[model samples]
Target: MMKEPTIENFLEFEKKYKCNSIKVEGMPIWSLYRYEIHNEIKKQTVGRTAEGSEPPINKKDLLTMALNALKPFNYRNVDVLFVCDGRRSKNADTGVYENIYLDEISKKFNSVILEQPENRKHSTPNGMDNVYFTDRVAFKTNLAVKLSTKFNTPKRKRYEAGVRAAFTDIFKAIKEEFGPDITDKMVDEMVDRMYYYEITKKYCGKILDKAQPKLIVELCYYLINNFAMSELGKERGIPTAEYAHGFAFPTHTPMQFNPEERISVLPDYHLTYSKSQEDEVHFPDNVKLVPVGFPFFERERDRYKAKYPREEKTIVFISALAEGEQISKMAAEVSEALGDEYRVIYKLHPKEFGYYKERFPWLANSKVEVIDNSENHMFRYLAESGTIVCTRTAALQEGIGFGCRVILLNFGDTALNLKTLIEKENIPLVDTAEEITDLIKNNKAAFVNPNGMYEPNAIENLTRFISEIMMN
Candidate 1:
C-alpha cells in the first residue's frame, strides 16, 4: 500500500513556492482541502463548495495563482482567458456568483482567456459565460492516448488516435485564435509540467500516468491547476506532502469518512436527492453535514422495474459483486441448500460488470440473475425480492426499508460496526449458507413483514438536505 503523505510536507512546498494565492474551480464536496484553502486561507472562489458554502476568494485568485507560478511570463497580459468547468454549483445563485467573480477577476488581469476543448463546454449551464475557457494542457487527453498505446490492439490504437486528433483540433483552434507563436512545443511542455504537478505525484502507483481515463482526468486537473497557479505567480516544483490536500471521498475512495480524520461530511443520504435525516455518529467538530438531493427517484424507480422483472423467488441483493465473491459463493451454497425454493439476484457494479461477467458466467445462466443496469432502481428490486444479503453494503439499509428479510453476512472484523447496527436495530444476521437456508425456510412470513426497521424517507431526507445545503 502507498503511504499517505504528511500534511507538513505539502504545506512546506506551498510555503517554499510562496503560493500565497490559490484559485480552485472544483466542488469541495468530498475534498476537504479545498475548503481549507477557501474558508481557512481566504482564497478566491471559482465557485461554491459542494455543500454550497461560498469561497472567500473570487476569480482573481485564479489569475493571481497562475501569474505567481509563471512569473515574468506575459500570460497576465494575454487578451483572452479560458475557464474550464469544474464541479457544478448548486443553483443559479452559485452560477451567477461564479460568473460575476470571474468577470471581476478578469478585469484585474490582462488576458481575454477562452476555456475549452469545445466538447467539454456542452455540460456547462451558462455557455455564454464560457466563451474562452479551454486548457490546452489536458492530462486526460494524453492519458487516454497512453492507455490506448499500452493496450496495443487495433481497437485500442484507434481509440487513442481518435483522442489525439480531437485534442490536436482543439489545440489548433486555440492557437489560431491566440497566435501561431503558442507553438506545439510550448503546449507540450506546459502539459508535461501540469502532469508532474497535478497527477503523477498523487496517483503514481494506482494509475498509469499514460493510461487513457486516468491520464485524461489527471491532465484536466493539471491544466486547470497549472493555469490557476501560473496566474498566481508560483513556481511549479515537486509538490511536497503538505501541498497534498485531503483525500476526496467518492473521487478517492468509496468508503465513508474516516472517523479518525478531522474532516467535514455531508449527511450520507444528503449527497443524493433523498431527504433522509443525518444519522448520529461520533464525528469531529470541524466536520459539517451537507445535504444532497436525488433527482432520479422516479426515473430510477421506473428503470428498476423495467430491467429486473419481479419473480416469485426470494431476492438476495448484493453490492460490490467483485469484492464480495465469498458472499456470492455462499449465496450459491445457500441456493443449493434451499434447493429450487429461493431466487438469488446479484446486482453487479455497473463499471465492473464486464470483469464480473467474465469471471462468473454461471451467474448469467443460473437461476441466480446478475443485474448490471444502474439506471434501474436498486431499491425497487430489493422491495420485490424476498430477502437481501450482503456483508457490508449500504443496500442492507435499503432492503430493510423495503420490508425485505435483510441478512448481514459477517465477512470479517471490518464489518463489526455494521453487524452491531443490524443487531441493535433488530435486523437479522445469518452466519452461514445453512443458517440462511434455515431462516428462509422457517421464517418466510416474518421476513416479508419486517417491523420497525424500514425508513423509506431516506430519499426525501436526502433531497431536502441537498436543497438546504445548496440554498444556504
Candidate 2:
C-alpha cells in the first residue's frame, strides 16, 4: 500500500545531480542515515553495493562503496567528500579509511578532501594531497552554535523564575559546602564532576541524592554563554570572536545554524557547507531511511524459542541500551529482578555497539544477550516481545504499533506529562520494575490509542526535499 521509489528513480537522481562529490558530515550516530543513502544510491546508480560487497557492511566496505559511487563522475570538476567527527578519537579503521576514501575520491575529481581535527596526530598517505585538517573545536563551535538557536525552546517566565531559584540554591549550597577557600581549579573540578554525574544519570540511569556543585557550574556555563566563550577562548588560546562562524546539526531538529551570522539552514542549505575546509564542510542534502528490514537470525523470538522451547517467559525488549553504562545497568537490574519470570533482551544500537562492547564487556558472558546484528530488526523484536521498556527511545512507538506493553522508565518531571498522553491515548506507562511485574502478573493487554503520537515518513519527506534542493 505504500508508494516507495524504485532503484531506477535513485539512479536518475545520481545522473541528474552528476553527484561527482558529496560531503558526508555528522556524528557516528548518523550511521543509519549514511547507510540508507549509501545503500540506495549504490544499488541504483552503480548496479552493485557501493563497497563492492553485499549487505552488513563495515567502515572499509562502506568507504569502498563511496569511492565506487564517485568513479563514474570522474569527468566532472566536482569532487565527493566524506567528513566525520574526529574518527581518530573513535575508531582506527574508520579514521584510516576516511583518508583512503578521500584519496580514492580525489583521483576521480579535481580534489578530494578529508577533514579531521587539527589536534589529532594521525599519519596518512602523503600522496592523498586532498586531505585537509582543520581546528576541530573551532569548526564544531561555529557550526553547532549557528544551528543551535533555531532549535532553542523559548523559556516561559515561570520557567525562568524557577531556573533563577534553582541557581540561587545551587550557588548557596556550593559556597556553604565548599567554603570560600574553593579555588578556581576546585570550582572547575566540581563543575566537571557534576556535569558528568547529571549526564550519567539522565542518559545512563545514575541518580543523585542532591544536585552536585559541579552540576551548578555546568548549568552556569550553559546559561551564561559569555563564560563559555571566555573559557573556550582560553583553552584554544585564541582571541574570542564576537560571533561563532560554524554550523551545528542538533539531534532534536535536523536544522543547521550559524551563530556568527545569525542565519539558519532552513532558508539556505548552502550555509551547511564550510567554506575554508573542504573536508570539514561536507553536508549532504539528500538522505535515505530504511526500516530494520525483514526476519533475520538474531530475531529475539527465534533465538529464545530455539534456546528454550518448553519455557514460557514474558519478553521485555530494551531497545538500544548503548549510550551509557549506568542506564544499561539499570535495565540489567530490572531484568535481574524479573528473573526467570521474564526474559529481558537489551538491543544495542548498531552505531553504539562498539561503545557498549567497551563499556560493558561483562555483557558478552552474562545471561543477558546483547543483540548486535543488523539483521535482527527492532520491529521483529517488538512484535515478539510482551512488553517494551525504554527511556524516551523511538522504539516505544514501534512496540505500541505491535500492540506490545510499553513502560517509560525514570522519566522524572516528564512522567506526569507522558502519563496524561498515555491516559488520553489509552497507552500504558510503567516507571518501575515492580509496576511492570504487576502488569505482567495481571495479564494486561496494551491498548492502542488511535490519537497517539505521529511519526512522519521522515525518509520519504527527506528524499523529496533533497530532490527539490538538487533541482534548485
Among these predictions, the greatest TM-score belongs to 1
Q: What lDDT would each prediction earn against the true structure?
A: 0.39, 0.36
Worst 10 residues of 1 by lDDT: 238-247
Tell me the tens digit of each residue's lDDT in model 1 across 337-383. Answer: 76676767777654454466666665655666667644334655675
Q: Could you estimate the TM-score for every candidate? A: 0.44, 0.38
lDDT value, residue 52 of candidate 2: 21
Clashes of 2: 21
Please report the TM-score between candidate 1 and the true structure: 0.44
For model 2, the superposed segments whose C-alpha errors exceed 4 Å read: 1-261, 264-314, 319-330, 333-341, 349-366, 372-375, 412-420, 426-428, 449-463
- Cα lDDT of model 2 by residue, 223-255, tens digit: 122233223333333222111112211211122
